[model samples]
Target chain A: MKILAVDDEPLVLRLLDATLNGLGYHNTSFATTAAQALHLLESSKSPYSCILLDIRMPGMDGIELCQQIRRMPAYKTTPIIMLTSLAEKEYIDESFASGATDYMNKPVDATELAARLRVARLIQNEYQRSAHLEELNRAQIEGFQPMAPFDFAEPVQIDDVSRVVNSRAMENYLRQLDRLGLFKIGVIGFQIRHAGSLHAANAPEEFYGILADVAESISENTREVNALIAYLGKGSFAAVVPRASQIDRRDLEAGIAATLYEFELADLVDSTSDIKVSVGTQINGSVFGNTPDKMIDLAVRSAQGMTESKPKALAARIWSLAG
Target chain B: MINSQETAASHLAAALAEIRARFINDLIPLINEMEYQRVAMTDPALAPEAFSSLQHASHKISGMAGSVGFPELGDHAARLDVTFTKLLRAPYDHAGVQAALDPLEAFLSLMEDILDEVL
Candidate 1:
């Protein structure tokens, strides 16, 4: 695969070239500045398969270079990886905004770089294949008989409107959803327990306050949530947390449930009544693979399982489903 | 089928209207209050009135701006508020007031640009 390695440092350039070549990768090109990199990219006879760029450099940085590459028609679809010494949150965000496909820290390990490159190639190939299939699909549709309108019978499940309208805490919940959705780990479901009792209670304001606090606290700790943490009517709340590849599904489920229990949310509310929390988790093998929507559905099922179990100080149930 | 151009234009218009309404109703009032305090502070005889008004005006503007996600504006207003508060709390400094006002004006322009984007 043809790779363009751009860095201002000579040592970094030499190391990357040697490392990639040692790993049996051929056709590597080098550029010291953003201008040189762009010049070579625009003029190079051979199309580069992937580009690795350093973030900090003289006369236009990697982010600007990546933006420039994206603007060019030839390299619009090319995968670009930002190599940087600092993996700060702002840099990571800027890298993504500038259209970087992947990011790596400077002084990158050869093995990890090779693995990332392989993944990048795979992702690019998959995207190209999908684009080709889409074109074929359109062609076939044009040639064949007109199909019926897509089925509208399936009712669209609107997640609890409160989550969206509750802007005060929505950012935290939304961030969790984004993280989980990206990972495509599992399904998530939410139930709002004690709603009726809380509303009917003498101190309704205090009860709601407790509920909001608990939701905010849970949202803070949990990431990789596939589904909305909906306020299931009657004061129950739930969400599905995606488990990373290295994570043990059973342990992850238990750990999250335990964390929720440990959160001193009840203290936030001036409540005289005892606080009870119940959670249900399922190992969604099928939904765990990928696809954000499917993963969310699986998480919802797991959350559904929690409501069925008897309520305790902190009740949690586990359900296993085939992937 | 709805045309994407039409959809985008409609959404943009709706966003713009909402932004205009917010700026007029919410943001402008706060700015006027700040201006009032600025005027009041010009006379040393009304120093107490000016100090209280400035404190109220700047704090409210700063807080509101921050809540609505125009934090840079909020920060500028906040810095100005701090300078005003310092002037009142300890000793008065005209140079600090001037320094703070310059940035506040810059931030006001920034707020206008941000409103355009949101709209």
Candidate 2:
């Protein structure tokens, strides 16, 4: 399998090269700086099987580089292993936050490194294979009936993992919003981009972990607006963030984006970060007069517009420091 | 031929011995740098930079020592790293500095004991 190793230290790189070779991992590439790594990745004809990145690099540290790479559609879920001497808890957390699949301590053991590389590649490939099988199975089912939306007699507990209400519940909530009158309620939809692929290769635990983090984040960020968040199947999550005062669509969008990113890719793949948010407001006596399902469809349509562009479509407002 | 598993194990033993020899040789420059940091960390005037540098050295050791078959050494370094980090962030005062330095000095003493055995 092909691999890319990036580090600022020549000695470190040499040791890595030696270790990989001793372990029989020969199809390897090297980069001395994060810029070089980016340039190499951008220019490659075929994607590398996995990446071994050094966390402490000059001119764009590995964490920043990982973030940038995660934004790229091509390598979003490619296994990224941080090979570095920076073993601090915060550094490790930041690496994972930025999309590192695994973190290996420096002076990497050749035997261990080889085994990790083997496993990382195997898991990635296995995930893809299983995903395809699931898709095939899904398509072949004759007269398949969709599962019913979950029903809860009691309010979902604070500790319950499922954050988003099911499709039926969403419809019920939409009815409430409609009857409440225009400007009294609002709804925003978040579609987890590439949901199929996310569930394709990952365990149920991982899939649910992301759902839980998203639920927790939405609850935390919109506590002020008292947003009621619900999970709509097929990777779509929605929240109704009501505004007492006239709420700028941008304000709702900003808070959602920031909170989502805070818990976004800490464990999920890069594509998981491709989530898109859409806002539907009722203001100026203009009620969004639609059924719950249709309102969701409208929200999805708004979100669909952003998904076409990706990562950038993630947020409505952005400010960048000028080069 | 060194093709048998036993022979391979011997070969691995030999290679590991060579790696340890190199490790001991390379560790000096790291210790030398840490000494400079130790001076800064102890002196109230230079404590900030030295404290940071000491923690950096400890982090490096923490990351490296384990692969060299010295997990205890790595743990000691990691603990020291945390001490330095805590001291650096805590309110900088004489008593606070001393509290931080006590753990810092203990970690250093532990490192010295480990290094002496290695040497």
Instruction: Say which candidate scores most in lDDT.
Output: 2
Instruction: Tell me what fraction of the real C-alpha contacts between chains A and B each candidate also makes.
Output: 0.00, 0.26
TM-score of 1: 0.36
lDDT of 2 by residue, B2-79 (tens): 466455556556666676567667667777777667666667788887777777677666656776687877777777
Give lDDT tens digits, candidate 1, residues B1-119. Answer: 35865655465455444533554355555656656666566566675577666665555455345433456666666666666666677545567555556655565566556656764
The TM-score leader among the candidates is 2
Question: Where in model 1 is the C-alpha error above 4 Å?
Answer: A131-323, B1-119
**lDDT (tens digit, per residue) of candidate 1 on A1-323:** 88999987654565566567655576899999999998999899977888999876767988889888876755655678776553344565456546666776544466778877886687558435654333433433365423222112211111112221121112223333353343333434444345455556524335544455545534543433423343333444444433442434343433344444455543212334434343445434342453444444554455545542232322333222111
Give the DockQ (2 decimals) of all models.
0.01, 0.21
How displaced is residue A122 in candidate 1, in Å?
A: 0.4
- Tell me the docking grade of candidate 2: incorrect
In candidate 2, the residue pairs with backbone N, CA or C atoms under 3 Å apart (3 or more residues apart, or in different chains) clash, namely A127-A201, A164-A230, A164-A231, A165-A230, A165-A231
lDDT of 2 by residue, A68-157 (tens): 887666665578887776555456545654666676766577776876787677746853565432332343233243312221221111
